[model samples]
Target: MIIAIVGATGTGKSDLSVSLARRWGERGLRCEVVNADAMQLYRGMTIGTAKLSIAQRQGVPHHLVDVLDVVDEASVARFQADARAAIDGIIERGAVPMLVGGSGLYLAAVLTDFRFPGTDPELRAHWEAELQRLGPADLHAVLADRDPAAAAAIGPHNGRRIVRALEVGDLTGEPFSAGLAARETPWRPYRQFSLELDRPRLVARLDERVRGMWRDGLLDEVRALLPLGLERGVTASRAIGYAQAIAQLRGELDESEAIAQTQALTRRYARRQVSWFRRDPSIEAMDAAADDLAAQVDRRVAAELVDTMGG
Candidate 1:
């Protein structure tokens, strides 16, 4: 059985996961945390991403956090593949895999056994060249013409998806959306849960968290990472805190304005998370702010594990 704790940034997902993992360990049930947040994957992004420290991990092993260089791109498809392998390893060791973090798409990809279209190296190279000259909007327009359904499904601002769709279409001689639709589930069935909080309370918590991040040198962390020279919209630079901090560093905004903007963005992101997770019926949603959250999750997981053992 897998317990996935998911919510927007600063929603106590990590804290809850850590507490649960430690609790399970005391119960002689081995447990490990597998990161599902995209931003937390990068090295040197600790404070901004609220990555768990070794001490905070409380000797419970964690997977996929701080495992990538800032320059490397960690895709949702890559995360799904790696996380599945990690889950299998944990289960083999008689351990429960606890999927944790706020990256809804990443969690969905793993939990639903969603398969992504395969990339063509040659086609990717060609598109890379074209992207330099044609720009993202042009590429997105091309995708819109070829696969309007896919274009509508993907965020217009998401250049990576737009480029991948066009590349897949060019390589396979079929619509990119068609390729995605043809993909198959790549994982065995697993039980999952989603941690939720009241919208107003979540937003208020996000505001406080963002303020704390600024006070705790989130700006400095971003500044330290700027020398890595990652381009805008690249995986690392596009992270929520990094993007807003870069604006301040670039003289586009002052410190106060940057903090305010970052807080607003975080609140908006939390809202989007609520919307996304609400659509998935498979997610056993529970109010994470409740005092008895761990007990509730334990009961849910214990019941499911009993059924799995019986089967």
Candidate 2:
């Protein structure tokens, strides 16, 4: 079965994935990870993203990580296709596929009956140009009029998403949120878990993690990626710590300001993730701070597998 380990950032999702894979291996059931984190899909975005190195992964095979260039736009539709293919391939090899990440939307794309509408390049370009001309707030006002639900959900600050919402609405002549509607039925046989942590504790952990990213030389990583078109990258350049690092590199923000801003944004993003996943009733919640999280999740998976077999 497809197993999803999801939560907000700094919730130890990656560590749990590796731990489960190792434990499953000990029991002679092969398990591999398929990354559902959007930023982790890009190569060379390691330190800021908290991506585990090859050594840290402890030889557990991972797919869909480091498969994209920084310059490439990260499309949810494209990722949905790639991630499903990877999961099917792993299942074909008689291994369990673990979908691991805090990216709630990405996880939903795989785990739910999510569908994507066809895109019209001309409509997309029109919305993108409108976003560039009018800015996110003004463009979002336009979306609010066209599809109030989408506008409320997307908010005024996210220009890229605003553009997509408008594009989808104009293209399909329906509310953008309608395109995101998913049935309760999953696309695959899956067991899902969402790690839960109290906001104060999670905020503290996320702030420290942001500081750790800077301590680990996020600026240096951004510098290394700049030559590889990181600055020109539509998606990569806007990543939380990476964006702050770029601002620091350009002398627009001091080191302290950059780090502080990144910490704040990371916490905000984490809240959004929690809200997104909280809407899904199928994901079982597990305390992220629990000492026996991995073992607990493993037992749940084992029970599910047995139940599947008995049926």
Candidate 3:
């Protein structure tokens, strides 16, 4: 059986995945992790992305981690094919594939048979050039006027996707949302779980998490990645803490200001993640901060996997 662990950031989703994997391993069940987190795909992104080291992983095999350089674009289409292939191989080997991360769209792309509209190179380049000249907010305004719903769905911060939306708009002369509202059955069936925490408590934890990343040498990690062309990478450059930390390094923000901005921005992003995952009725919610959270998740996943295997 395949399992997906999802939820908002700072909700202990990663820890719970390790807990369940350890528990299942002790029970003689073989399982491995396939990451759905977009940022963790880059190498040398450990401290900021909270990527586990080999020692921390405790022999649990992980796929799709560190598979991309900072220079590579993270394409959901590519991930969908790669992850599904991994899941299929794991199932064939009689081992379960545990997909984990808070990247809702990437998770959906892997779990569901979502398709993207066609792209034109020249049209895309035109929009991207406009993005460079006018910036994401201005380009986003153009999309808002052309297709407000699409603009709303694709946030202004996501310049790559904003470019795609405009390209689709130019090509189709239709609202990009029309393509999104269409859906189909998932690539494979699995039990999906999401973690939840109280807003106040989550905020506190998020603040600590941001501080922890910095304490763990996020500045050093970013400094190392800079030589690897991190700033030139469109997607990698804007990652939550990475962007602010880069600003700090560039003398745009002091260390304290960068940390504060990262914390606040992360909280807002987490809210968006919750909104994205909650819209899917298939995901079962679980208490992330509960003392018995690990056991509770184990029990549910245990029962579901048994029934699935038997059937």
Best model per TM-score: 2
Q: Which tens-of-lDDT digit does each residue in 16-37 have in candidate 3?
A: 7787888888887778899999
Best by lDDT: 2
C-alpha TM-scores of all predictions: 0.84, 0.95, 0.92
Model 2 TM: 0.95
Looking at model 3, report the run of 10 residues with the lowest lDDT sum.
Answer: 177-186
Relative to the true structure, candidate 1 reaches a TM of 0.84
The stretch of ten residues in a row with the least summed lDDT in candidate 1 is 179-188
Q: Look at candidate 1 and give me any clashing residue pairs.
A: none
Total clashing residue pairs per candidate? 0, 0, 0
